[model samples]
Target: MTEIVIETRSGTLAGIGEAGLTRFLGIPYASAARFEAPGPVAAWQGTRAADRFGRQCPQQFGGKVRRDVLESETYGEDCLYLNVFRPEGGSVGPKPVMVWIHGGAFLAGGANAYDASRLAREGDIIVVTINYRIGVLGFVNFADALGLPAIPSNIGLRDQIAALEWVRDTIADFGGDPGKVTICGQSAGSMSVSLLMLSPRARGLFHGAVMQSGAVSLIHDRERSIRDARRYAEALKLDQSRLQRLKTMDIADLMRAQAIVGKQLKNAIPAAPWYDGDVLPASFDEAVATPTAPVPLLAGATRDEVRLFDLMPGDILPTKWDDLKGLLRDQFGPEQTARILATYPRSRKGRIALGSDLTFVMPTRHFAERHARGNPTWFYRFDYAHPLVGAAHGLDLTMFWPFSGLKMALVRGGPDKGRRAELGQRMRSHVAHFVRHGDPGDIWPRYEAESRKVRIYDLADSFAANPEAERYAAWAGRDVEPGRGK
Candidate 1:
């Protein structure tokens, strides 16, 4: 395990650990950002220590406890890096490669959270997990703010592009076929992949994509994104002249500002991708309708995706009940509100399911349907729930990466272990096959206009066309307004 050395343009680095594979951790892709502007990392002479994880960019604490995770790791302005994993006894010939971008809304998450060893080891492919900017430091827009000459909005995406460039140039030495790369991610990461699908800068960077639980439908416009920035600025009390003072402020201070701004707006400002007329020219539906990228795609969502984040449904039930019919009419209109209530009664589980379908599940299906019209598309619905948790949003990540018995351990106390393993194999196989041959395996036919087939992941695997029709029909056929929070 210790004898393997991977040589890249920057130099050779040693990696440890195994999942029946050779795993390399924390290899630099871009130069350390300084003063917040994107820059190039000058080439080095000696073997750089690409053995450890890079510093994950700064972000606010939402729910997950990651303080200890960050304690021993180094982080700084120069934090652009990625990790690679390959099967130990993998065929000597080139292997397919998959690059992963993580999701924490768009405010936080890192490559370190996921260990690609299991995927690389079992699937016999090259697995790369990448780190990118998050929160105000990464996506906050201030292009016209004269005080900050160093900061740039969307540095996070630029970092992702740089990482792909690194893979194109350096991955072959690590036993990967750069030409067969498949870029995949979930939530904001999926949103990132969607943007890259339309980006001229990202063209030819990868041959395929797999998006889980996110799509192009939710990207904020420039005005919306800038409005978020203004909220952040107001939270920090930074005037135009004092805006540059942000770089020197404590990272924690910025994080607090982010949380404050997020709270002050009552969680309204979603500063994700923007239609900058450059990276993303229009909304995802508009772009796809115009025939955006021809790249083969695999896209889907969990059966109850919103359970992980917005678990409580009674919150909405109470907020609108005072003006129940009017608010219901606001959402579904007077004519259709009654129909919606009839379809999804206010039971303990009904509202939660409705919320999930409205926010993540149905939108994802809509995205696939729109894209399938123009490109080869595959759709899936993950419904295998753990005993305590339903088929939640992040469960697929646990199976695909299968890391330190962490998430799997927490969720495996029931009779679902065998089912989990089966689903893991089937899903991983589809992902690996997609990376290699631009297809998601033989589980189901490619989504077509007439057939509309989708591979469903439950206690057992099955095939159907738009299997969530009941929920989808309730949402689509009826005139429900988009989720206000989304």
Candidate 2:
């Protein structure tokens, strides 16, 4: 085993060099007090071991503990850290960099959940995975509700920006090109990517972006944020006027309160990034209409994005015709609901199809159409499905990181390891090409409103022109309220 030591802006990190890649894990980018904005890490006196993973930001992983929770035994408030993976030998020229943000409904995941060694080795690019605060401590806008006008909003996003800033300033020492950075994520992390695109603070941090199964529609407004925070405070049995007590409360007490409020809200994860008028603009539609940064984008969704919700222990999915109609009425009103119902059948499969299109497919297509007008963009649909789960919400992650072993068993299925590996290589190749070059090569054509061409990834990958045009037309110009769809 070879040990490598490199100097960063914060300190000297000792990492491992093997398999033609150098990995430095758990390096702090910033530090912060609870609910406060993050600040740069002070320089350390001596070399710090980056061999073991750092503590994950405090979170509750539903009933079952996730891999991230098991990997890192420690969890606490001071959890702003990032990991770096680059080619082993220093290249003559700087390689492209890919920074990944994880997804856990803005509640549960961390940087340790991902292993980017395959991407770094195969793509010959530097990969960085980061941890940011989540849940009430990270989001929960308290500026106006608590009368504490000085409290910072969107501390999670601030942490992400600080990590990006660290990458821009020090990535060169690890053989990465800071100017050629690509930020990508899935689910809530994907929402963060879109929000970052609209954020002035994250303006020049990355050159390109990739979003999977999420868009700007998930962001909450100030009014909703205040309501959620007040609800959380009430769940804790704390006086709303005495908000200072929350800052010093036990972390376990806060998490229990969060769980209670989350149950009351009928949401598994209650808190998320919100439009603060500073980091994010007032209107997502308006922001997308007139984009500030015309960066290259690779955006797409799985064919049955919402089917994964069926596996959860709840009545979340619509099982019957009446349930489906009720949901449509709530989302699109009676007039549009009648039209949507007429377009599809009244069965379980029909409901799943409608819910999938309404929540994930349509939003992604709309964003791709608007973004492609001024930027180099590519759109795709993942059609590979498991026998039981189908092409669900997180199936794309298995393909993006194929060598994840048993972590991907739920999606990959049995006796088809070879086929899964082939598909994964194909998808990763396209991503690697897009990261190094601005476009996704000549095989996949650029998406335009006139053509509406989309790459379909399945057993046999092919290009199609608006395959679901009729279904998409049903949702034309219709805007669902934020947080209602998910």
Candidate 3:
């Protein structure tokens, strides 16, 4: 095996080179105590082996679907590490960098799950995937609610910022152009990209962004976040006054308490980024209305973003037309519900479409629309779905990283295997183009208010003017219901 050594700000790292690509895995960007902001990693004299993936942040597998993807990996608290993949050959100048953040509803997933060698080779760019704290340890708001100044809020986001800071300071040694860095993510990670776009701490860290199947609507209000923290504390049998006990609690106990609280709240853990007013603005609307960084963005969602959740065993699915209408009324209220129902047909497929739009598609469009007002933006809709599942959530991941053995079956199960591979390559090429240049090539038009065009990705990829325009119009200027946006 070919091995190479590179010097970074923290220390000297030894990595392996293969297939015209070099990989540095599990390099620490920063170190931090539990529930504290990340601090710089101290320089070490000896070269550290970055051959294996770092331990994933402590997490639990929630269901079969999650188990299928996350259960095989080991996890731990000291998970603030990132992996770097770059072309082996030297270039005249540094290449563009793409930092990826994984998605698992802010509860599960880590950097190890993704292999960036293909993206690095194909795009001829540097790829960095990060591992950050998730669930209670990362997102629970305890500083203000419990009156504990020691407990830092939004530590997960802080970890991401620390990783970006590392890239800004050290990527040049690895042949990456930090000045042209692009931050990309899916689901919760996409939400993170949007939040970082507005975060003062994340300013100048990245020049562009790509958000897939997520948007700015996932953030919770401080009140809601504090309440969830209280519930978590109660599950741990600790009062607000005894919050210090959490610092010394066993990792197993902490995870068990998190699971208990998650179950009690019907899996609605309040463990998400919140509007701290300092780190994040009050609302997504406000943040996008006046962006702190007006960087070009590529954002969109799949045709069935919520079908993945619905496929799980739950009584949440509507049985009939009346049940669907009632569900809509309960979520959007009577007046807006009437408008939505009028715009959408009353059938199982139609209900699923509505759910997809409310949860992922519409929020993405809203953020894209507001962001387009100032900066260049491109939007897309992933329409290809495997025969087994129809355009489900996270299905687009198969297109981005098709070589992954874990995802190959999911992408190749449908008819025409060769055709699917070709499509996946096309999608990756588009992403590579976006990372190299701000635009997504000439075929995809920049989103504008006058022409709400979107690139549709299917067997026959094409551009369309305002796909599902009328349905989106129904929810315009209306307050999107809570829980529906997730």
Estimated TM-score for each candidate: 0.87, 0.93, 0.92
**Rank list by lDDT:** 3, 2, 1
- What overall lDDT, based on C-alpha atoms, would model 2 receive against the true structure? 0.78
lDDT of 2 by residue, 287-327 (tens): 55647467999999998887887676543233345655665
lDDT against the true structure, per candidate, is 0.70, 0.78, 0.79
Residues 1-486, model 1: lDDT tens digits = 464666777777777744467767777777754335455566677666556787777665453334433333565555687888778776678998899999987776788888777677667889899988776667776564334544655767878888888889888888788888899999889878877887777888898999998766555666666677777777777877775576677666666776666665532333455666665664433455555467889998887676675543222211222243454577666656665556766764776566566556666777677678878999888877756768877877766656545545685434225776677778888888888788977756998768778888876888887675665665663322222323
Clashes of each: 1, 0, 0
Model 3 — which ten-residue stretch has the worst lDDT? 63-72
Give the CA lDDT, 0 to 100, for residue 207 in model 2: 95
The C-alpha local distance difference test score for the whole of candidate 1 amounts to: 0.70
Q: List the residue pairs that clash in candidate 2.
A: none
In candidate 1, stretches whose alpha carbon ends up further than 4 angstroms from where it belongs are 17-20, 32-37, 63-74, 144-151, 267-271, 282-290, 311-343, 405-408, 412-416, 470-486
Error of 3 at 64 (Å): 11
Residue 356 lDDT in candidate 2? 74
lDDT of 3 by residue, 183-205 (tens): 99999999899889889989999
The predictions' CA RMSDs to the true structure, in order, are 3.8, 2.7, 3.2
